[model samples]
Structure formats: structure tokens, C-alpha cells
Target: MNIETLTWGTLDIKDEQIYHFPKGIPGFEDDIDFALITVEDGPFSYLQSLQNQSVSFLLSDPFVFYPTYEFQLPESDKEELEIADLVNVRCMVTIKEELESSTVNLLAPIVLNPVKRSGKQVVLHNSNYQTRHGLWNVSQDHFEKGGE
Candidate 1:
């Protein structure tokens, strides 16, 4: 199917690539359907809303930056998505940038079921997690070790 994307312009996406968020993202409850389009040569992706042209989120896999990160969602949420196995799950964190620092929302992650084409942004109850986790910390640590 062909869709107009903000980052990719008019592009073709496989039907299997479409994701449905029954309850939608926290603030974007009305926008349910979306397609994940990767940036041309970047690690980021755009979670573009199928219904709204202006509604899109920049997301990145947390593990790409923070390999040690872990998250657990309530069992009730798992039932909502019919998540039966880890293979069906894909986790992404929303990114934010400021003049001084860049951050990622690790407390709430957008989880998707590629097979079911459904998704939900789940907020973890873990007290150890924070809404804004510094992405720079991970970068600095990697750089210090001569790793990219």
C-alpha cells in the first residue's frame, strides 16, 4: 500500500508493516493506525499516523543505545495485545532533544505485535525507571570505551 509519509514522502509499505493501536498512544488516542518508517540512513524511525499527516513520533530501540535496560509491563496489558511470545514484541522509546541534552522515555515504551499489527504504549510501575533517561550517558560510556 502507498502512503504519504512526512519523512519518506510517498512511499510503499507492505500491508504487514501497518500497526494498529487500539487505545492509541497516550496523548494520541484518536490516531490508532500507523506505519513504522525508518530514516533513510539513520537509526531513528518515524511512527507515522495513518490518519493524520502531522502526527508522527521519532522512536528508537532502547537496546540499540542501552543494552542493559529492562522493562516489565502489567499482565493485564499483555492480555490486551494478545502478546503470546517475545517474537511478536518490538519495543521502542520516544526520543526528545534539548539544547544541552537528549533524552529517551524509558518508563513508557511503545510495544508492538508485528504479527497482530497491534501496539500499546505501556507505562512500567518500576520505581527505578524514569520518564526522561539521558541518552548521552549511554553515548558517553560507549565513546570512552572506543566503541560506537
Candidate 2:
């Protein structure tokens, strides 16, 4: 299938590669169908919407930056996605940057079932997690002083 994207322009995508988010993301309820397109020679990916050409999100695996990161979804959510094993899941986070710091939402991770091609944005109820978790900046003096 040929997909029209805002970032990558027109591209071909296999039908099986399309991910369906029945409930959509928190703010993008109407745009449920998306394709994960990796930008050429780039670390980020574009979650390009099939329903709306303008709707797209830059995503990346949270573990790439925060190896110790953890995510948990409620039993009901698991049942909804028909998730039986962790191996079938692929997790990603939407990136956000602020002046000197870049942050990813550790509290809400977008979980996808590759086999089923379905996904959901699950908000962790864990108290230790936050909506905006800053990335590690080695250049900061406080980080060198063991402030991380």
C-alpha cells in the first residue's frame, strides 16, 4: 500500500505493518490507524497516521535512553489488547524537548502488539513515574557530581 506522509512524503507500506490503535492516542482519538516509518539515517521514527496526513508523532524506544525503565499495564488493558507475552510487545515514547533538557513520557508508554498490529497508549499508575522524565545529560556538572 502506498502511504502519504508529511515527513517522508509518499511511501510504500506493507499491509501487515499497519498498526491499529482502536482507542487511538489520548488526544488523537479520530486517528487510529498508523504506520511506523523510520526516518533515513535517523534515530527517531515517525508514527504517521493513515487517516490524517497531518497527524504524526516522532517516537523512539524508551529503553534506548533509559535502560532501567519499566512499564506496567493493568490486567484489563492487557486483556483488551489480548497480550499473552512480553515478547510480542513493542514499546515507544513521544519525545519532547525543553531548552537545555529533553524529556520522554515515562508514565505513558505506547505499547504495540506486533503480531496483532494493534496498540494502545497506557498510562502507568505507578507513583515513581512522571509525565516528563528528563534524559541524562552528561555535560551537566550536577550529573557528574552524581545527581542522576
Candidate 3:
């Protein structure tokens, strides 16, 4: 399927790349279908909306930046996505001119059931994570040092 995106122009994506979001992401309830375009060499992916050319989100694995970042997937959400085993989690990233200032939304992560080809942006309840967590915190070496 070919989609015209504002950022990437015409993109011919495979069927497997499409994901259905029944409830849609927050603030984007009307846009239900998106293409999960992944970056082969990096920790980033593009969630591009099929319904809107201007709607696209940059997603990244939260764990890549915050090794200790963790969250529980609510049972209700699991059931909704019909997730049995395999699941993919990514957070929306807000990029800035200053790379150090970019933020990732940990409070609400985009959860996907690869087998079912479905996804949801689950807002974590009873969690300490915020919508904008610094994308670049301590250096990567910090994790190697195990925080000293």
C-alpha cells in the first residue's frame, strides 16, 4: 500500500507494516490505522497515520535510553490487544533542535501485539513516569558502570 506522508512523501509500505488502533492514540481518536515504519539501524520507528498525511509520530524503545524504565501492562489492555505472548512497546518522542532536550513520553507508551496487528497507547496508571522524560540523560557509559 502506498501512502503519501508530509515528511516522507510517497511511501510504499507492506501489509504487515499496517497496524490497527481501535481506540486510537490520545488526541488522535479519529485516525485508527497506522504504518509502523522501523529504522533498521537505530532504536527509532515511525508511526505514520494512513488517514492523515500530517499525522506521524517518532517512536523509540524507552529501554534504549532508560535501561531501568519499566511498566506493567494492565490486564485490560492486554485483553484488548489480544496479546498472548509477543508484544512491542515504544514511546512517542518529541524532538528538539537541541538533541539533548528531546523528550520521550513514558507516561503513555504505544503497545503493540505483533501477531494480532493491533496497537494502543496505554496511559500508565499509578506510575511515576511523566509525558516528557529527558531522552538524553546520563551517558550510555553510565549503564555500563551500573551507576557506579
Candidate 4:
């Protein structure tokens, strides 16, 4: 379906790309549907809202930046997203900007269940991870290193 995006002028996404967030992404409780799109050869991507064209988030695989980053999928989140195997899950972090000084949200990773076409932003409640981890820490040889 065709959608007017917050970043991209307009986009046509496949039905398979659509994800339903029943509880929404924390503060965005009213916006439930979204489409994941890649940023043309770049490490970044976007989680664009199908429900509200104006709402979109620039995302990136946090692992590429902080290789040590990890989190447990609270059973509540797993049930909510209907997540089964680890292969069925994908993680994307919010990229605040492109500058080295910019930050990425590592504490709350957005998890999507491709098999169920559902998603949720799993907030790591009591972790040392921060919401604004500097982007400069990203590995310079991203392509040389494999990704999930």
C-alpha cells in the first residue's frame, strides 16, 4: 500500500512489511501499525508508521555499533509479540542523528516478530544500557563484520 512517510516523501510497502504493535511503542501508544524500510545500502533503516504518516523513526541494528550489546526478551514481551525462535526476531535501535555525537537508544530496543508481523519496544528496565549511547562507538568495519 502507498503511504506518505515522515522522512521519505511517499512509499509503497508490501503487506508482509507491515507490523502491528498492539500495545504501541511506549509513548506512541496510539500509533500501532508500521512498515520497516531500509535506507538504500546504508546501515540505517526506518520504522515508518502506517497509521500516522507523520510518525517515523530512524533505526539501525544496534549490534553493528556495540557488539557487546545484549538483552533478555522478558517473557511478557515474547508473549506480546508472539515470538518463538530467535530467528523469528529482529532488533532495531532508534538513531537520533548521523553525527558522531549523535546517540542511539540501546536500553529500549524495538523488537519485531517477522513470523507474526508484530512488534514491541522492549525497555530494559534495570540495565546499565542507556537511551543515548554515542553513535561514535560503531564499528568502522561494519560490512567486514557479519550482521544478524
Clash pairs, candidate 2, are none
TM-score of decoy 1? 0.80
lDDT of 4 by residue, 1-148 (tens): 8999767787899998898989888888999998988788767878888888888887887777777777777888888777888523234454345566677777788888888888888778877766766676555354235321
Please write out the lDDT profile of model 1 over residues 1-148, one tens digit for every residue. 8888665688788887789999889989999999887677755777889988788887877777677767666788878887888523234544445523566676787888776778888887844556666665556455335342
Highest lDDT among the candidates is held by which one?
3
The candidate 4 region of ten consecutive residues with least summed lDDT is 139-148
Candidate 2 lDDT tens digits, 1-148: 9988776789899876689999998999999999977667755666888999999876766666666666567888888877877523234444445433665666677787777788888887844656655564523444224333
Cα deviation of 65, candidate 4, in Å: 0.4
Across 31-148, the per-residue lDDT of candidate 3 in tens digits comes to 9999999999999999999999899999999889888878889899999999999999999999999998888898899999999999999999987777877788766565345341
Cα-based lDDT at residue 74, candidate 2: 81
- The per-model lDDT (C-alpha) reads 0.72, 0.70, 0.90, 0.75
Candidate 3: residue 27 lDDT (0-100): 94
TM-score of each: 0.80, 0.80, 0.91, 0.83
Please report how far candidate 1 places residue 147 from its true position, in Å. Answer: 22
Model 2 lowest lDDT segment of ten: 138-147
> What is the clash tally of candidate 2?
0
